[model samples]
Target: MSDIGISTKAMGKSGVTFSPLKVLKGFIPKLDTKAIVKNALISLASILLFVLLWHLGANYLFNIEATAKIEKARTEQGAEAAAQMEACILSGDVSCQPNTLPSPQQVIVAAQNLWADHLSISAKKTAFKAKVATTNADRKAQGLKPIKYTGRPSFIDQILTSIKTVFAGFLLAMFIAIPIGIITGLNENLKTAFNWLIQIFKPVSPVVWLLLVFMIVKTLIRDPELDKSFIIAAISVGLCAMWATLVNTSLGVSSVKTDYMNVAKVLQLSLGKKIFKIIIPSSIPLIFTGLRITVSVAWMVLIAIELLAQSPGLGSFVWEEFQNGANDSNAKIIVAMFVIGIIGFLLDRVMLFVQQSVSFETQ
Candidate 1:
């Protein structure tokens, strides 16, 4: 009994003591050394090549020659503005060639400046909120309504607006597509009827959808100044992006394994129970694939929809900057392009993670 107790104690100690590093190793994915090195080298080379091309194009091919002529012309004028232009040109300044495609460094600076502006605006918003809270407390005491901020949105605000718009559109697409897909998948006649409509509408442009939705919304909504652009943009994006999901879901449901259907029928399962227990579970993989595509399509279409609708998003910001024609406008647009690309990539990765979590196939 003493020996057994000692062994039990040893086992307990062994169970309680574990290497943290070993525990962490189990959570971390195993790396493929060769693949990792190869990918790293390829990515590095691509970035370096891009930077070299941009620098050469900006300084030698397109910008420097035109800037030199402009500088010389300004120098001959003997004005104070000429001195500033000369200084800017000498430092490889963006102001020297406002319309030229910015160098990578210039784009980086623009991104930094935009980030600074976002931070400044955020600080202002905090102060404004505090002041409003105080005033709102007093207004409430007097039985008056609290006023809201109506200031122009900042860069970050525009980005968040774009994200919100895309999500709204994506949710709307899922709601419309999933039900119709399930119903049509169960009925051949319904599927055949909808096929013609899907084929016709699937190829339609977001701009066309926006115009149609705008007309409908305009007629329904009473106030023109109301925030109806969001509704219009979201509807347009949903209409354009729902097709992939609809097609994939219908196919997935219609192709449910015969064995599964047979088992459900043999068990005398109700239609609702069979659908919920068998149909949806078996078709989840394909459904997730379609959802991933739909989200990607929604994000892509959102920019165009926002721009057309004059909505407060990155798309509108880009358009406004382009029309403003400021010296930093080109750089701001470049920065926005990077932000858009990065956000899209992140959205895809998130969907992929969700797919992997639900599906049997890891890849």
Candidate 2:
């Protein structure tokens, strides 16, 4: 009787007790497991099909090159030389292999090689830092600069450099565009005055921007220790990408509802308060949309700017690999190409997520 009474008390007025099984059942109904499995399977199948096609294409190109080499030997030298060429090709000699489109497997191998190279470089950097620790400390005590590692950067380091450059450019774009956009949006005359400038610069090429920035930065920044290439690339990227944000911000601020403006006036809010409390809040969705576009544009133009500026990033890596023309160079290039695409996709997704997070409509 006491046990029954205790159980009833635990159940409370609802006469129900907590059950782990019941909670699990509640969550199970919310999840469509079959659909998730189906989608996963479909994605796997698609990747496999792509790999198979790539393998077939790579083999076809290899055979064509091999046959050409053998035929050339037969025509110029002799049947004996042709047989030797065929034997060399069949022996899995890299010299006889065609340097064309790499198979998916080759790309995978290249990626692994890059990762290994990064690890090796990281180890070297660590050892170098340790070796200089005491010397660096002495230098610091003497008010001198610390010794730094000057080794070549690995593929991973290049990737990090690129990400840093893009973010720097993005921040610059935001800082310059938002204030100008707000000022212009607040006054018709300002908008009219800025319209021509925006229209003229909006269509300018990234290379042109790079050259313009290079000219200005070179004239201004005379410090030899500063990374001029990185500065030029970042500035060029910002200049090329800021127009979308500027235009969108202006449009957003101008499109605020008349009722909100009237309310702000009734409250007798200061210019700053009105902008901060009403204008910005109302314009957030469009502002975020513009920001999203700006980020995408910045990333797209970054490669070109980095290439021209000779910034130690993926752009430089690609250029170097192309010039290398080694047996594995094509594979490495393919690897970089895929990395670029994946990173671009991720950046867009991140921007989209941020936009959705702040916008009520998206929520």
Candidate 3:
């Protein structure tokens, strides 16, 4: 009787002891917050150190002999001229060594100036639009057609143009590559036939592709003002960037499980059903991976293509600024470079997110 009573008491104590502890454990986070904070601080420190190093290196005294004349002029011309010269050197206004490698502060100031210039241009555009509207109303009343603004493209406009060109090329590559890849993957004979062509074209440079595209486009297109450069650039980008997608998609398709094929055969599915339900769904991950690489290649190739094609994009903007060699030219180029890198990173991250969303396996 005593043993039975002890067992009952022990069972009664077990419910209250473990249940609340398990409930409280569920509220705890799996992540190590301290480690995350530590990593963030380390990244911040490294960036700060890099900026500090850049500041030191850019401002270091180089070609002191060349700048001696300016220093002498500063000493003799009194405080006003000396201050002006100093400001000019710091801002890369004077044509010298300092002008070539602009300091971080100078780049920042140049960014500000570029923003201001953009704002100024925007204001002018707004005014021009207002004038155009007034003139168009009058012209419409007189049964005449409206005239659009024909001013130079702004920085933002060039950026948008680049984006459009890249997307156009990327879409073209996808359409060409995915269909061909699927076929090649499904058929060994077709893969063998196309393998040589893929090998030959994959190593060709973007500049070479641009030249080839130009030759073809020039023969076919007679109009320059109707956006011919854009077409050529897009075609060139497509040609250069399509190989990755083609290869990956083929591999992905070929690597599909034999069991899947057996099942499809057992089910006696039609060709379309087999491709859509079995092959394409399984190959999406690799195809997307290829697409990410293709997009990156397209973006990288676009700058060179635009430079060669003289298209009104960031590539042209960089080339124009380099040729112009103004005080702020280097900084503007740097700005464009950073913008390109940032955009590429964002594109990769977006593709990664899509891959994760659709992919079967995740870690």
Best by lDDT: 2
Worst lDDT run of 10 residues, candidate 1, spans 61-70
TM-score of each: 0.85, 0.90, 0.83
Residue 264 lDDT, candidate 2, scale 0-100: 98
The true-versus-predicted C-alpha distance at residue 37 of model 1, in Å, is 4.5
Better of 2 and 3 by TM-score: 2
**Residue 179 lDDT (model 1):** 86
Q: CA lDDT of each candidate?
A: 0.87, 0.91, 0.86
Tens digit per residue, CA lDDT, model 2, 52-90:
999999989988888898999999999999999899889
Give residue 184's error in model 2 in angstroms.
1.9
What is candidate 3's local distance difference test score?
Answer: 0.86
Model with the higher TM-score, candidate 1 or 2: 2
- Off-target runs (Cα >4 Å) in candidate 1 are 1-38, 64-98, 141-145, 223-226, 361-363
Whole-structure CA lDDT of model 2: 0.91
Model 1: per-residue Cα lDDT over 185-269, one tens digit each: 8899999999999999999988999999989999999886578999888888898999988988898899999999999999999
